[model samples]
Target: MKIKYLYIGALALLSACTANDEALLPAGAVELKGITASIDNGSGASTRAVPEVKDAIGRTAFANGDKIVFTKIERTENAINPFIYSNIPYEYDGKNWNRTTTDPEKIYWTDGTSFHTFIGYCLPSAITTWEPDDKGVYPAELGAGKDEIDFSSLSEGNNEMAKEDLLLYCNKSALAASDGVTTNVSLTHALSNVRVIVNIKNFAASAIATDTQTKVIDFKLLSQPTRYTWGGGSNTLSVVKYADNNKKDIKLWCPQPDGEGTAQSKTFTFYGLTTPQNETYHGINGNNQPLQFSFTVTYPDPMNPNGSPLVKTYQGAFDKTVNFNSGQCTTLNISLNHKDEQMFLGAEYSDWSFVATPDLGELRKKSTYMTNVDETAIVTSGQVDNIDDATWLYHVGKKVYDIYGNDGESAAAAYCITSSLQMLAFAKEVKNGNTFEERFVRLDADITMQSSATAEDYQWKGIGEGSNVFNGTFLGGDRYINRLNGSPLFVKLGSNACVEQLHITAVGNVTNGTLAGTNAGVIGGCKVIDDVTLSGTPAGALVGTNTGTIHASYYTGAGNLVGTNSDGDKTGTIVGCYQASDITSFTKEFLTNFIDGTDGENPTNGLNDDLNAFYSNESNSKKFRTKFNYTFTPGSYPTLKVVTE
Candidate 1:
């Protein structure tokens, strides 16, 4: 047997021609050049035939909306040659031999003795050979048959072929040859060529790009800034107007972005304005919105600059020297300023001057009176010419009449004698013998003299002979006698006499001879019977050397007398001493008895007479008496009363 094959040489052939010179080519056929095919054995491990193609499909031009179709044949015999045949019909739009729809006149067939054909379409321009079966019973098949054709490849190129579809059959065989005895041969047709077109005009540009813009607002100045004074010298910038007497709060609001408010606010202070004005405002707009604002400024008058005047006033004398003794009639001239005139009258007089005056009665008389009167004549009526010459009679009413006229009467009788003639008559008779001695003698009614004498005689006759014998018969008489026997025995009546309550004070180095005493002489209240010496004895002519009292007494000038007996008892030379009526002995035997250290005896033996004499004579005798009374008053007087409230 012999194998049959289908072949086609590369030739440009036209099935039909037109006057327009366009060649009418077969519609379902594609030209094939330098094409080779191979078939795989039943084991699929080796190819019996390999197909080669010089040009492969390009992938860039591929897209969706394309179609593809395949035509196939198979060989089913084994002989010295193989015959190829197709059992199933090629399908197009669900019909066999359907070339009339798309590829018309593209089918052909041949038997061993003859060839068969469809009038509508012939085999495609590209031809491939098919062999028979190993049994040599079936003819070799060619063209695309049902079993060999891949419709998926044909539909792809209806528009354009995808790269994936062409890749599926790149080296595949379109024909098959076979020998007898279990060998099969087949052929396949793949429409791998594809066309692509993209409709870019149908697409719209991606949403147009967009951006946002925002608005902003800013404010400019509305007024010029002013100055405000708050207090003292302090001043601050003020957008609001204020007077000197008002104070009020000021506020401002600035419009900004919907969310952003004021950037800053200012506060102003004023002294005396009640309302504020001329304020400026500022703010920021975060959302870039326009800004609008309002401001209210207030000034209050809290103080007045011209309220009250300050004033000062002065009272009393502003001058340095004040004539204070100008009597009650004197006036104080107080200096006054204009401010002082505004002061209340009651306050002004409170600082007036004071005046002083001397007693006019005292000034006129140049003397002080014991009576209360303004006139000196009232005090001078009964005043004695000389107080030494006449005694002060009792005052009558406001007068102090003296006993100066005629009556030579006593101070008591002169006031009692009222008859002027009788008073004069008595005065002449008294004038003849108006002597102090005569008057005293007449009053006593006794001639008791140491020697008797006449009124005109200067000497006491026979003072040492005759009937008045001086036989040393004196008893405290020498003192009076010696004092009266001075050269002028007569003392004028009405003359000032030395008859005051006398005191003779002597101190230090005093002696008994300095002060002598006659019979009536007494040493500190003890009558003197003999000539007493104050030498070396605790006694003085004025005061005993002991501290005590002497009442209604006189003293001669004699110093202290101090002595100590043989038994060491001390005594004053002139007077034995007593303290609160306790006799202090100067006898030796008595002193020795006192020194025997016995409890019942007086301790007079060691008494210091000289010390007692010096204290009594020279020291302050009153002080000694005061100290003695203070220390011994308790023991000395049992019934004494010390009165205190």
Candidate 2:
């Protein structure tokens, strides 16, 4: 789980520029000095740390052929915009100087004036200055939330995107020393840098280059902001890159170096990235989830190089919003985890293919148990294939129960069909009536049923009936839950089941009687299960193994949400475990309340790995808040709603 890091530092400014000694200097003119700045290599430049950062270098060191821009700052009528002046080409040769201007006097300046500098990558020849809005925010591009500086101009032909080196030193104070004038100035990065590194897990060097001929290409970043404002010649500018409606290729044919040490990975660097004044600006898509900046990777098919390319889009699980500070070099590591060839789409071409097979493919399957047939069901009978015949046992010559020949069997042992009527209807319509749809569809009915024999009325109105509930054997191993708004619920499943898009209110105990499935989803409103223990991946309030999208979902409770993988690693994700456009909401309270239990409280309580897992993991889900115009209510257990107003 690698997270982006923001590196910061200050470079001491040296005075070296001097006026032609023959001409008497202006009354208060100051001699210019040489500039000194160093890039802070986040990771040890010469050695590797546990969590390494990228290395920094001098302005002259543009590994990819980029140059630095130099200018001076002056006051302007626009309250929020800076006045850039005195553009010059100056250089520092370690200890000496080189001035590109024909007149040395032109480069020299008065003591009271301030200096401003930056890289010219994507900078328009003449910028259109405008007044700030009522909120002091300059106008943003039509689709974007803020005005972003367009670097798309740097795109180099059919297969190229924008990448340039940049630095900013604004409003640097200068004074004429009584003897010799020297100014103290520190240059910071005007744009943030994103280093996209690719890694293929469980892959050998031979397979990467020869067998799979793995070439990562067409690496584009979608939905990024495109306008910006250098904050009035200030040291730091609060900028916003308006979201682009379409995807843009920022890197073409990113290089793949032999991965070093354990996780063999390759790295590509994208420069001149702008950060937003509000780092949480995740543009809302049609489904209302925060839009994500997609990282699409394509490779040539070894069998059919001219055919459609093998593509895989990598989306981060939690932090969909880009967060970069001044002079920060952030890293985004994408790993192509190796799995069975049958699981990859291009496996037919090569045995060494690495692609995530289609699971739900942007389809969100949900049911309220209130309707026998939901026209909006994203999980159709077609998506439900590979029914396990062995589990579909015959009860008295009738295929009605599990191997044990009973109804309401512990979900751990089998896939329990919560609705008897719907099961019969679905089985009859099961493509050819071969098997029931269990692996994808969740069985959580909102029907009324007796809680216990001793009780007078039907208190529990959901999955599972009274005494004989857990007795029936389940088939086809789909995740099943018996829950009401806030009451205790029972959950059971087989290894491949994934629970998604179900809402639960109230403070109820969620008992995972069986730990068979690898994933689960908590879409809609759900209070954190009081007591939860399972071995597989436990996705929080939003989703488990989402291949499509999850939005407007949340969890609220005093209990702790806990579970870990077989290796004791907590693989609990909040949203977007396997696909893109998965949006999850978070607040200070969500982070503060849902802690792993402290005392003899919830067994899964007190765990703090959620923050890292949801935000820093490989899942493509974006984390956002109401302040960012994300339409959701706020509270101990907040709720998401349609913002009609």
Candidate 3:
């Protein structure tokens, strides 16, 4: 096909034919002659038929829309020479090539005897797109170092041309014409073929039973070009720049088809691949980046029917060493198996109270007595004077007090005595002695020392001690135990404070060691019976809390594991509260708010509600369960295997 350059006025008049003479070429112009296409079957195992000039119906195989290129080979003796070409558009009716532009460089001339031979002619060119200002100069061959291609200017034309159609081929051997004569040329396919097949086994049963609902929905072959070379030269494959964020998708020939048996496979074909050079690509889109295959699977959640579908993605690396030679079909087989299990961040303890807040019962009663003025005395009768000298005593509304000292000056002894005095001053009823002991009071500060060899020698051994013990109506005192009779006993704790860990045989009120602030309760141990594994019945300290609060305290001897609290109660290194039994209630306006003690040190908003601890919807019951691994014995509750990372 040949296109006459659109020109006007004088130029048209000169080329126009009149009755007396035939149209003629301009003084320095050369005719484009005929164009041809040859397919290069020797390059690969596959062979493609040459496009016929006209099909059975007489319609041209490739005509008006096809492109023919004329290039000037800038030959050099030693260096590589890229083809410098120009566009000579084909017109449907015109049967011969012609130069329509008036530009001097756009025109080529031939020496009559042996027409100054034109270097080559290319049809179905790939260099269809060019910068407008470019003169149609395109690289003859692409080297490993060449990063980009500029096909616009051979002599500076501004208009751009894009080879919109897939590249069928570029003539392997350059074509030339002598004495204004024309010859036919053949072009070969520029791209190689590649095939990918995925086989799935046991389609009816998935390796991961939980993922049975998973089904492949989509697949993609990333980072392959759609077309190869443009201008005709050596049949070299076109090269493209690899971009990290950009990737071209290979067209899919088929999606997953219904399987007829236990195993099924689907095949996809992609064209325009480079020949097998046995090279490996690195990332999916960088130099030597291997081609990557990725697919999406839609997994239906059998456990949660109304939940959103789980879109799982699986990706694989394609063999970079496998090359796609011209017309060579490389098939890649991928077998689908169970996907690797994914891990998630997990918590160990159930109903793991994350924050500290007043227990529901405390909030319900709305009772706050720690700050009540008339309820607790603001001041004791008198300050404790010389401990060994004169005795000090005082009386409050319904309580009696006494002043005492430790027998030894050891640290433990000092802590006991000092703590005892602080507890008395907090009660605001220290007295000269245990006189008129209607309400007996003894400081058992040295209780921890009781385990020591000289424990019996420690002065002030428990409350209501000494010969001054209840004479008649005086309060009861048993060597090392406190006998408040019916009066309330206030115990204070100091460093190394120890509790006998005995079951609460009697009811009593326990509060902080000082009246300094709210929830100022001492950090120590008290007793409550619940279900425990060590004991045949519900009795061990770890069984569970039967009443009161276990807060800001850790046991050195033994304690229950996290899951041992089958009752779904809270237990950890932080403050937690359990409901009181009918036998006793936390009566001292208890502040189980040990968490609030640190103020803003902790970031948790508040403690987990005991009721909400369990995953169950039941109220007032702890049932929240963690997915973390745990061990469960026959009678014991589940115990978290690992609590911390």
TM-scores for all candidates?
Answer: 0.14, 0.32, 0.30
1 against 2, candidate with superior lDDT: 2
Cα displacement (Å) at residue 155, model 1 = 99
List model 1 lDDT by residue over 338-402, tens digit each.
22232111101111111111111111111112222222232213343322222212234543343
Candidate maximizing lDDT: 2
- Backbone N/Cα/C clashes per model: 93, 44, 59
lDDT of 2: 0.32
lDDT of 2 by residue, 232-294 (tens): 333444454545443332332232222221222232333234343244455434323342444
lDDT (CA) per prediction: 0.20, 0.32, 0.29
Worst 10 residues of 1 by lDDT: 264-273
Candidate number with the higher lDDT (2 or 3): 2
Most TM-score-accurate candidate? 2
Per-residue accuracy of model 3 over 109-136 as CA lDDT, tens digit each: 3322322223333333343343222433
lDDT-sorted candidate list, best first: 2, 3, 1
